[model samples]
Target: MPESVGMILTLIMNIALFSTANYLAVKLSTRNVKRRIIAGVVFLLFTPVIFFSTLYLGFTWDDTGWGAGIMTVIYTGLYLLNGLILLLSAIHIYFKK
Candidate 1:
């Protein structure tokens, strides 16, 4: 529960999520350059939308107990997913072949 421990755990989790997303994106796109480009663009647009929506929900929600715990998980998952997507998409765009 220490701040340093929490930061380290968060860093590890983000790296894991980003790695998974990168793998999936490569597998899904395979040798299709066009597919990868399109997916990158689409996810580029979607990432910020998801990020802002998550922030909005976090600020508006007032639930406690199980509800709050569940929401936390959901929000974290969403934030991680979108963030990884954004990063992977940018990589793809920059390294386009």
Candidate 2:
């Protein structure tokens, strides 16, 4: 397999893994239809945001990629989203009982 192909595969895998995890976690954590929709929508929106904004290093092709941190904010955004979902889940559990 070509290095570029491998790199692309890895990138897609990253997006899929994170999005899928978040989708399931938030979807099952709450019964509210609105919250479920929001969780799905956020994953959809986040996919593109992380995809376009992150720089693909040459490591994709076994070469050195530009060590740019331009898309670092996406990481922060993901962390924030994660915390938001966890908090929302806790709130849902609290009010449900």
Candidate 3:
């Protein structure tokens, strides 16, 4: 199978895992805002970790220059986009008027 196929399958599998984990974590925790927030925060952290790990695996198997450039652009764009969104969210949450 192609690296892209592997990447797609990995991405799909991780999404399922994260979703189920989040559901179970929140469901099994004692009813409290802290537990839910902790689960959400952990889910947030896992997403990018899983994404980059699968991306790294794909990178290792891919060889084309065009694929490299496209992946670089995608990876950088996603990092910047996610960082900017998180920054904005944090500012809004912690600095609300």
Top-lDDT structure, candidate number: 2
For model 3 the TM-score comes to 0.47
- Evaluated at residue 45, the lDDT of candidate 3 is 64
How far off is residue 44 in model 1, in Å? 1.8
lDDT of 2 by residue, 1-97 (tens): 8766765665566568676777686657566655555654565556555554454542444454542232334543674577565656666665776
Write one digit per residue (lDDT tens) for candidate 3, span 1-97: 8868866665565456545764586465434444545554555565566556645655665755455445545654544454444444445544553
What TM-score against the true fold does each predicted structure earn?
0.45, 0.44, 0.47
| Top candidate by TM-score | 3
RMSD of each: 8.5, 8.1, 5.9
Regions of model 3 farther than 4 Å from truth: 61-97
Clashing pairs in 3: none
Error of 2 at 54 (Å): 11
Instruction: Report the lDDT of model 1 for residue 71.
Output: 42
Q: In model 2, where do residues sit more than 4 Å from their true spots?
A: 31-62, 67-80, 88-97
Error at 33, model 2, angstroms: 15
Candidate 1 residue 18 C-alpha distance from true site, Å = 0.7
Off by over 4 Å in 1: 46-97
